[model samples]
Every structure is written in structure tokens, then in C-alpha cells.
Target: MSTGFKCRNCGSNEIEEDNARGDRVCMNCGSVLEDSLIVSEVQFEEMGHGASAIGQFVSAESSGGATNYGYGKFQVGSGTESREVTIKKAKKDITLLCQQLQLTQHYADTALNFFKMALHRHLTRGRKSTHIYAACVYMTCRTEGTSHLLIDISDVQQICSYELGRTYLKLSHALCINIPSVDAFDYLICLLASQYLLERI
Candidate 1:
């Protein structure tokens, strides 16, 4: 004899028995339908078969089936060490490039953060690390109101300006970063200042 019980919350018939909690829960809405009900017998039902089976429920955890977790071919260390190494290397590269470009420390840190985001998005795959670093710096400068031009970064990195521009565009589009337009007056001011300093020294 079976008694029909409907969930008061969702009125769902898909109820599951929680033996540990001694409660009947609605699987649909996760509401407790019946509580503190004493169960006389627990029957284990085999999956893919309609009839109930009189056997103990074997846990995959106890059977050693779910013991080991792996990352297939991508496991480098135990956990997260490989990812940390990649980040460290990227930071070092960015720092060096920033020093070469005479960027301030704030801009360097900002560029490092952007490079980390690009790495997380897998945008650095199949591309040279130098190009990614250069692009990050370029984008950071543009977004932070700095006057560093793409040609200036390309000249310092000894890479083609076209390649740096392409990578910058790709990074901007992939990351959805809205970089502000470069002010022509900023460039003119920088050039004039540099010429004056050169003439003085």
C-alpha cells in the first residue's frame, strides 16, 4: 500500500527519500515534504531497470572508482603550480618591457594585470610571448591616458609595428576593452619636449 504525497511548495510528484535526514524531499523544488518519518526497510534500485533489487548500495567512492582526479595531458604539477609559473614569467617579461619603455610602476602593474587576463582567456596561445607583452603594454598605455605609441613599443621591442598593431587589435576585441583614442596633441607635446631635452643635453 502506497500513500500519495504531493509537495506543498511545487506540487511535484518527483520526491526523493533522504535516509540520513529522515525526510522526504521534493526533487523538483528541494522542499521537505515529510520529516522525521521512520523507515522500516531501504530498497536499492538499480539504474536502467524498473524492478527493485535487494542489494546494498555500493558507493563509487568506496570502490575506488572516483579516487584519482587528473587533467589528462595538461597536468603540469600537482595543482596550480604550472599556472603560477606561467604568470610569474609573464610578469617578469612585462616588467622588463616596461622598464625599457620607461613606463611608470603603476602602468607596469596595470599591464601585468591585463596580460594575466589575456592569459586566462587563452589569447596568448600560438602567439609569441613578447608580442602579447607588447600588446598588453600598448593597451594599458592607451587606456590609462599615457602617450606611448605603438611605434614606440615596437621600436623598443624590435618587432614589426604591424604585428604589434594586429595583436593589440586582437586583444582589444577578444577582451572587449574600450581603449580611448590617442590625442595628437599629447604626441606633439612629447616630441617637442624630447627635442628640447636633446638640445639642452
Candidate 2:
């Protein structure tokens, strides 16, 4: 049985097996070729009960194992909480801005969607969230054929008018969003409203 197998170390076939210890030894280099061979079967027999049983066991070698979930339970829970907090805050700010500007529900919803998109694109980086939010509202008004100048939005949001304009331009170019030209009537109406409010003050 040992003659067919070659010693891996010395390439010798002079192998000897010790049945008691279950080890096959290479006689040429005194190296162990194989050890702890399972050569016997375990039998269970009942003498007077007239019952005999035989069992065979098998095991498989595994290359590796994997887990289903990558993140821990606490990590996933905390991440969900953080996301919810951010969304809730954004919604509150957007709603307040819309109310202050007296925007209709339709326009408010459109602006909210635009703000969410800008958040998703990370366009608000290194700038106040309020600025991005105001820009979205301004863009939404323009898109909906309503006139709201950058200065008007900046006044409402308390952001610098020039900074808000630059932010809006950056967002429009980066997102490839094309807003329609403001209608002449929209500007006229806004101007008249501002003059009317000024006269009242």
C-alpha cells in the first residue's frame, strides 16, 4: 500500500506504517508521510435484545464561510437614527421658508424635491444648508413661472444675495438643471407688491 506513494521531502518510496500509532513513516529520510489514519469502524451491539446497529460518519472540508450582515446591530440602528434626524430638520427648515415666502403648496413641494436632490448630490458641501435651501426655492419659483429674485430669496433666508446667486449658479450647472426665463408679468407683479408694502410702511 505504501509503495505507490512517494515521500514529498526526499522522493523515496521506502515507507513503513505503524498500525498502533496510525503513522506512515518514510524510511529514507525518517519523515512522517501520513498520521492518524481512520482505519477502523465503531460497532454497537446488544447481546440479548437481538438488535444490531451500524453507523458511518462523513465530514466535508470547507474553504471558507461568510456572514449575511456586514454592519453590527448598533451601527445600523444609529445610522438610521442619524438619517431620520437630518431629514426631519431639513423638512422643518423647508416648511418654514416656504411659509415665510407665502409659496403655494405646489411650489413648496417642488422646492422640497429640489432641495432633497441637491442634498443627495452633496452640492451643499462647505456651505450653509440654509443657502442651498433658499437657492432651491428660488429655482423652483423660476421653474414654475413665478418670479422670485435671488435678492428676494436672500432677504427671506438672511443669506448674502451675491453668495446665494453664486450657490444657485453652481447648483444649476452642476446638476444640469435648466430653469425657464422669468415672465415679464411675474417681475411686474413682484415690483408692484414691494412698492405697495413700502408705501404702507
lDDT of 2 by residue, 111-154 (tens): 66566556556777798888788877887877676656667777
Top-lDDT candidate index: 1
Residue-by-residue lDDT tens digits, candidate 1, 18-56: 443345655443344676655457665566845443323
Local distance difference test scores for all models: 0.67, 0.62
Give the clashing pairs for model 1.
none
What is the clash count of model 1?
A: 0
**What C-alpha lDDT, on a 0 to 100 scale, does residue 169 get in candidate 1?**
73
| Segments in model 2 whose C-alpha atoms lie over 4 Å from true places | 1-76, 182-201
lDDT of 2 at 101: 86
Separate clash counts for every candidate: 0, 0
Worst 10 residues of 2 by lDDT: 61-70
